[model samples]
Target chain A: MPDSAFAEIRNLDLFAQMTDENFAALMRGAYVQNFPAQIDLISEGDPSDFLHVVLSGSVDLFSTWNGRDTSLATVRPIATFILAATVKDAPYLMSARTLEKSRIALIPSQDVRAIFDVDGNFARAVVTELAQSYRTVVKSQKDLKLRTSLERLANYVLRQQKRSGEVSSFFLECEKRRLASVLGMTPENLSRAFKGLVPYGVQVEGTRVTILDQGELERFAKPNPLIDDTSV
Target chain B: MPDSAFAEIRNLDLFAQMTDENFAALMRGAYVQNFPAQIDLISEGDPSDFLHVVLSGSVDLFSTWNGRDTSLATVRPIATFILAATVKDAPYLMSARTLEKSRIALIPSQDVRAIFDVDGNFARAVVTELAQSYRTVVKSQKDLKLRTSLERLANYVLRQQKRSGEVSSFFLECEKRRLASVLGMTPENLSRAFKGLVPYGVQVEGTRVTILDQGELERFAKPNPLIDDTSV
Candidate 1:
């Protein structure tokens, strides 16, 4: 494998256990592509032929309903997307688009399958990654189904704080509009939710948010392992 | 394996790959426990020490948020819960409680791990079962995030109709209250939604639901694979 491609594979948890030779064989026919900002990398309902690894920039995953689209998640650099579908040979569940100018590695699903079968380590790594992804989605489901819109935003802020290791402040990773959709709410409702959190010690300024009181926010959000990051 | 246990294992997809001798060894240290209705069998956040197989009756898997609990799903006879957590040695995300008088098989996680390392067929079967369980949870997440309550109920009716076959009316396997929570709606709202669905040609007579018009419900639900099934 090329040094650069090897570095890319190292970043993916699914390829964590791959031997150098196995990794090279797996990527023998794979190639990289650069996508411009806002490019639709993969559309929902399209057949998934490649297992995508985001090499650089970010990918936004969202789904449309009745002409309205909502953000499902943002795939950061060094992670794979639509992997379960790729393994299951199913169509993409949500459309993925580049949030900024990005580069992605495309490995044919057939190669992935072939390599996966021969590499127990690779298969185990895939199992772990897929399980984590599955848990994250389930947590997101619990968030959507169990919490009100305001509660969701409050918890989201604390989760970002935990991710950044800055209890007081963290920059918003995406637009409020997109964030709202990801949280399963309307943009206007998300705006209103921000205002609602003022009493809970949250302050939002443009794309940067500051938490004035962590305890108060936690009291309102009630962060749990299923919803927020304790290990990270 | 005992004759009765052998007959039971035959019905489970997870154990379908096992030969009789292989299965007997796997079950050598396994034990069975019977749970009465409404018993809390497994609590969330506890260590996953054993792999649970529902031998009879049913189980309700759910998570709590802010002192209120939301139903995640139900497990009928012969299904397993927390397999991923068991394999990964992670904390349980959702608690499992008996919904009916039940018989459950518990195999120590250590025993499962031991058998998994030596039995290639069992290892493959375990991975396959974990992958499928993970995908089902992912699909449930899609069900929660990508659809409104009414849409969820509509799609749920279709799913139940499919599960129970083309009968005019079929009894719900679980309680209406738990079903309401699983569908992410209030009992009151579920009641109103049932009334609202009269136009869609679905009728809920007690726990016996009749899909009077499948075409209308399908159109109204707009069931997409990504949102409905097979997306994960």
Candidate 2:
């Protein structure tokens, strides 16, 4: 593995505290691969043989049923996805595809579970990560069930703005179509929702979104910490 | 604490494998209480001070934003709730309430955390339980994002019948209104959906549903194990 790749993953909470010996054991079985954009990284219902760490770029976590697919989440650099399935020896619940040319570290599931058996600190970190992931999905469920497409779009823009250093304008991470899927709306509904937000002061020019009235949008969106606070 | 409660939780995978000594430590700090129906068990944003196990009866895990609320999950007997929060020392993401008079065991979070610190077995168990919880929420998210209310309700009935030992009829777990909330629909919409399913042979009278054409309903719902399998 490249020193940069090793350094990036070693710095993660999931790996930072482990003894160098055990960490070495894991990396010895690990390989870092470069995946091209839009490549299928993993498929839902496949056995989770490896725990993946996206070293750079992004991957979309999505699911499908009855010929319909929707975005479930996106995995960015320096974090792992499907740890729950790896540890539990279960099939992947969602498929992952690279949204852009990306580098990812593949650690064998056996290595992960084996180290977890001997390393209390590693096991502790696994639980912590899983807990955070569970809460995130729970929040998303609340967002989907409690909000309309318009409200969801509004809050999502506000959230992106906050993530981009509380700027007046920022870019959406996903394409509008995938963003619509992530927000549980169709492309047409997303367009209408963008139009629906004009009164509250949101302007969308392609991917660039300028918040003309932050206060008005906040009042309309009401982004609660329990649901919107990523730091939590 | 009652022996029956201890016996019940001991049978759970979360507690089943811990050393007897550690389990004793956990139980010693734990207290079991009977809550009357409709009592609030925990609220969103409240510090997660204790981990709760439902020894009997049921608890609805629900969340609210602005002026509306929806059911996120229901915890039946012989299972735990808010574990992810309790372990992370975070606020409850969803508020919980008794759906009926319930027996619940509350284990101090500190004790749970304390035991987890020293017991590898307990820590491993915690990871497995949290992983399973995460997957369950992921499946629910897929259901919400991918299916219409009518489809959700249809599958819910078929699943319930199967849960009740593949019987021809079964009592709905919650009242129609609460069921609608869980299925992400208004009561009127849920009622209409049930009527919509009448042609497929779903008969709903109060809480009891008789499936006149099981094959037809299954064909309509098209329950995939990836989405509907509780065993996974």
Candidate 3:
């Protein structure tokens, strides 16, 4: 592992509360690897033997059902995926794949469980992380259940814009197909959803989106913090 | 609090791992209350001041947007609700209401947080609980996104049947309207969806459901463990 990688892992909110001794012990069993885009990192039903942390680039978490797949979420750098599976010693519920050339640290799940048992700080940090993750998934479910496809798209664009520094316009970081899956809609429906948003003061040109009227869009989307807030 | 209520609270999985002194301390700050059916216990966006544990009967966790409400899940006896919000000290995302005459124990969120910080076993238990909750929500989201309304209803019936001891027929636990909301459909759509399921050998008589052909329904629903399994 690079020195910078260790520093980066040490600084993550998940690890910040961990004691130095426990963090060092965890690092001892950890290894870093780089993978090309589209490489499968983990598959659903596989035993979660490692707690995979993305150090650079990103990974897409998706699930398959009856030969059909849907995008769940994307894990960016300085974050961990599948921690719940690792912590519970259960099979992975979702498969992960590199979205680009990415670097990830694989920490042995056994080490994680062991340290979690004996390290108070580490255990507390894990609790906080798991709690936040649980709330996030709950919010996502509410968003999906309460909003229509067009409304979901409108709010998603607004969220993306906010994430990109609250500009009136922003570029989509992922493909339209992936966005459609994430929003729980067909690609064709997503295209129509974009057109549907046009009257609500949204304009899409290729990967870029401009919010022509924030007030009208907000009125149409009715974004609720309980459903839309990503922060813990 | 009644002696039975205290005994029930002590036996909960969330309290099982807590140290006796910590558990006692928690109980010292806790109180039990009885509520009539349809009484709202907590509202969305309200501060999570207490960790509510159902001792008897049940509570329906639900959300609302734009004058529409949807059921999220039903919390039965020996289970805690909104732990993620309590642990994170965040607002409750879903409002909870008593489904029947219910008894609930409310432990101050501050005491829970304080004890969690000092009790390693309790911390580990919280992690396990939170992780399980996170996966359950993820599975629900996947089920909603991947399956058609009819398919969702089909699988939901199968899961409920299994929960009712794999019987060929069982009574629907909640009202049809509440079940419809939980399944992310209107009562009218649910009625239509039940008709759609008849070709696969499902028959509903008022509150009772009979699965005459499990094979046909399973084939149609195509239940996957990643989406259907509830056990942690």
Candidate 4:
């Protein structure tokens, strides 16, 4: 890896605590690559050979069954995906694809496990990262089980709005179809969900969303931190 | 904790590899108790002060939103739940309750973190456990998003049957109402879902489930290991 890329990764929480020698050992067999948009990086059920770190652009983590595909999550810059699979030496549960031209660092899973066995700092960081990942998924499962599609979309808008500097208006993060899958709704239902939120002062045109009334939408969505807040 | 209880917990993978002294330190502030059925053990959004281990019986991990309640998972004997919350020192994301008369061990979260900072084996075990958990949740989310209620029920029955030592007949593990919530469907819908599987030879008599035709059900359920096999 180049110095600049190495420095960027070193700054990430997962790597920040690791010793320089161990970090170098982990990066020894790793390589950085750039892929065009819509490229498949890894497939579900494949051996988790590499731990992927997205340095730029975005990746969509998705799964398919019975002729249906759903987006499980989207990985953005300065984040790692498939670490759980890598650590467990298990098959990847979700396939990842590039959402746009992107740069990613691939570390061999063996190295991660090898270092984890010997490095306390890396092991602690891994535990923290996995714990965070586990909580995020639990929160997501709660969202899927306890809310209606409209309620999900409303909360999603609020979350995205918060991500975008708490702005009143901002562009949606991904395509509507992918968003629909992530929210566990059909595209038609997503459209109707947006329409359903109109009463709460949410307006959508193309990918742009304007929350005219945050309080009104909050009342309708009833966003709970335990369910919607990933940061916590 | 009693010596017998310590031995049982020591045999668990999470604690088996730690030094005896470190294990003793963890157990110093820990205590075990028995709770009656339907007793709430932990509430969502409260500080995750204890790492709970179910010594016997079962506990339900669930969430609620806007008056709607859903079952997230059931933790049966000889395993831990809410470790993510405990390690993160974050609020409990799911409320836990005993589904039956249960014995539980509560270890102080601080002790878990303190020992985790020192024990490589325990930290690695935590990684392994959390990775397994992360994959299980991903599989479940895929089950919810990619399959209909009927498909989920079919796959669920197949899974339960496997759990029953590949028997053709066994009782459902939990109440139908809880099963419905766990499958993300209404109780009425769950009833209809069971009926929908009749053509494939699934018979439900109260909680008694008899699979008259395993091949037919697996054909319908597709039973992808990626989604259904928690062991993997």
Candidate 5:
């Protein structure tokens, strides 16, 4: 692996507290690889063997059932995916695929488990990361259960705008079909949902969304911090 | 707390690996309380100060928005709720209430965090518990996203049947209204859903359910371990 890659891994919250020796030991058995867009990185029900860290580009975590699939989450640059699965030595509950040409570091899960047993700081970091991940998912569930699909779409647009540096308008980072899956709606429903938000001052032209009336949308979406806030 | 309470807490997977001294210290600030049926225990948006462990009976975790409410999960005996919130010192995302007369232990979140930082075994145990909790919620989301309400109801009956010691007939432990909320449906929709399942050999009378044809039900439910398994 390159020195830059090591620095990237070292900088994540999951590794910031680890001793240099332990971090080096973990990296000793790790490697970095690049994959083309749309390639399957991992599949659900497969035994988790490596802790994957996305160094660049993006990966979509999704679940499949009865020949249908839904997007669970998207992992962007400089974050780890499937840490919980790796920590528990459990099967991947969600399958992952690269959304674009992406670079990722794969650390042996066995090394992670072994080092976690002896490194107190590493263990604490793992607990904190896992706990944060768990809480984020809980929040997502609350949002799904409590909000209507139209409200969900409105808030999602707001969130995406904020994520894209608080711009007044921004292009959606994913396709509308995938966005519909992520929001737990049919593509037809998503189209109708966007139209429903027109009265709330949301303008959708292709993938570009402009929040014309932020206040109106917020009032309608009622985005609760407990459910919408992503920061730990 | 009584001796039996201590034994129950110690036996939980989260505390099973902690040193006895640390366990005793945790108990120093912990207390057990009893609540009557249908009592609200904790509300969403409240600061998480205690890690609640249900000693006996059951607790229903649910959420509300815009005058509508839905069940999130049911916490039975010998399990913890809000561990992620307690660990992260964040506000509870879901409100918890007792479904019946129940005994519960409340441990100060500070003590849990303190021991977690110093005790490696305890830290590992927290990671395992948190990871397992994360996976369970992820599975629930997959179920929500990938399956229609009818399919979810079908699979839920199968799961409940398995949980009730694989009995062919078992009483629905919760009220029909609460079960409807948990299944993310209205009481009317749930009524229709139960009727929809009759073709698969499911019979419902009041709170009683009998799976007359497990084979037919399984074929329709398509229960996948990745989405349904509770065990870590």
Candidate 6:
């Protein structure tokens, strides 16, 4: 096993409560792979085999409809994606691809299900992780339904910036066009929406965005717990 | 304990795995009560003390904003509601009330959590239930976002009819106004949409809607698995 891969297991929430013996058994069958930027990690409608955990760099998780694709979310280092799919043994709702050179911990879904059956703590952990993911998706729905296109964009900017602390500007983790689709707008409309936010103190330069007026932007965005917080 | 109360235990997914001894110990503190229609069993923003299971009739789950209420979902017999809040020990997201004379099982959250710490199989069962509930909510979000208002209502009717079987007609379960709110539309708009579907062979008579054209409605709704499947 790679040294970095062991470190990655220490960081996954699903394995957090696991005993070392249990976790080691988990890593016994697990393997880590490094993918170059733009490599397709998993595709939508494909059978899910492994739960991918991002250890470094970023991966864009997205879905396509009627020949158009939209970003579902971006996975950052130390974050695990696809627990729900793995637990339920369901097909991937969105495809994942590396947005940058990335290292991911690929744990087989069968092992996950097996350990979950035999290990009590691991099962509880799985439950919590799946529940949180489920809530995040629900909030995303409320967002798309309750808010307009411009409102979603404004709030999306606020959420991205808030994650980085006091940073006034940060680069978007996913493609600008994909982010537009996730926000439920056409790329053209998304471009226009970005221009409209200029008055609300949002400045977009390529993939990098600067929030000039956090207060004003938040006021306009009104990020509700049901819409923004995935921790519910 | 009432004979009927034990029957409710069979309905809960969490209690499905408990041994007779474990199940009895867990339910030592449980109680069953019946409420008349329109009784508010739990209110939003209130403490979640017990996991409520519906045994008979229906319960409407909804939220109120600025004195305006929106129906979120309806709970029927043999299913659990508010496990998310109960597990987190958080405030209720939406208020739950009886839609008809209803029987409910209330298991103290403390007992559930206590038994959870000791029973491995029970813990796994709870986790599975929570995870499943969470995914159901996510699917609800996908439905609201991916489908139009007309499509949402149309699919919702089909879902309701499917759940109730090939019955020619069924009750709405909630007020038309609440149903409208749940569908994310004004009562006027829902009424108008109902009228618009006349050519599609829909018949709405107050709270009783009969579908004469299931084929046409499904064609228009185009229910996706991500949106339509409750277990997703």
- Model 3 ranges off by over 4 Å: none
lDDT, each prediction: 0.80, 0.92, 0.91, 0.92, 0.92, 0.78
Write the residue-wise lDDT of candidate 6 on A29-72 in tens digits.
88888899999999876777998889888998866543445566
Our model 6 lands, by Cα RMSD against the true structure, at: 3.1
Model 5: per-residue lDDT, tens digit, B21-134?
Answer: 999999999999999999999999998999999999999999888888889999998999999989889888899999999999999999999998889999999888888889
Look at candidate 2 and tell me the lDDT of residue A181. 94
My TM-score estimates for the predictions, one after another, are 0.93, 0.98, 0.98, 0.99, 0.98, 0.87
Best-to-worst order by DockQ is: 4, 2, 3, 5, 1, 6
- Which stretches of candidate 2 lie above 4 Å from their native place? none
Q: Where does candidate 4 stray beyond 4 Å? A: none
Q: Which is better, 3 or 6, measured by lDDT? A: 3
| Candidate 4 clashes between residue pairs 3 or more apart in a chain or in different chains | none
lDDT string for model 3 (A50-136, tens) is 999999889999998887899999999889999999999999999999999999999999999989889988888988888888888
Number of clashes recorded per candidate:
0, 0, 0, 0, 0, 0
Q: Is the docking of candidate 4 incorrect, acceptable, medium or high quality?
A: high
Q: After superposition, how far is residue A176 of candidate 3 from its true place, in Å?
A: 0.7
The window of 10 residues in a row where model 6 chain A has the poorest summed lDDT is: A63-72
lDDT string for model 2 (A1-232, tens) is 9998999999999999889999999999999999999999999999999999999999999998899999999999889999999999889999999999999999999999999999988999999999999999999999999998888888899889989999999998789999999999999999999999999999999999999999999999999899899867
DockQ, per model, reads 0.49, 0.86, 0.84, 0.89, 0.81, 0.39
Candidate 1 Cα errors over 4 Å, as ranges = A230-232, B18-25, B117-121, B230-232
Residue A196 CA displacement from its true place in model 2, Å: 0.9
Lowest lDDT 10-mer window, candidate 1 chain B? B223-232
Q: Tell me which of candidates 1 and 4 scores higher on TM-score.
A: 4
Task: Write the residue-wise lDDT of candidate 3 on B1-232 in tens digits.
Answer: 6788888888877788788899999899899998999999999999999999988899999999988889999999889999999989999999999999999999999999999889988888889888988999989988998888999999999999989999999999999999999999999999999999999999999999999999999999988888897984
DockQ of 3: 0.84
Better of 4 and 6 by DockQ: 4
> Model 1, residue A154: what's the lDDT?
88
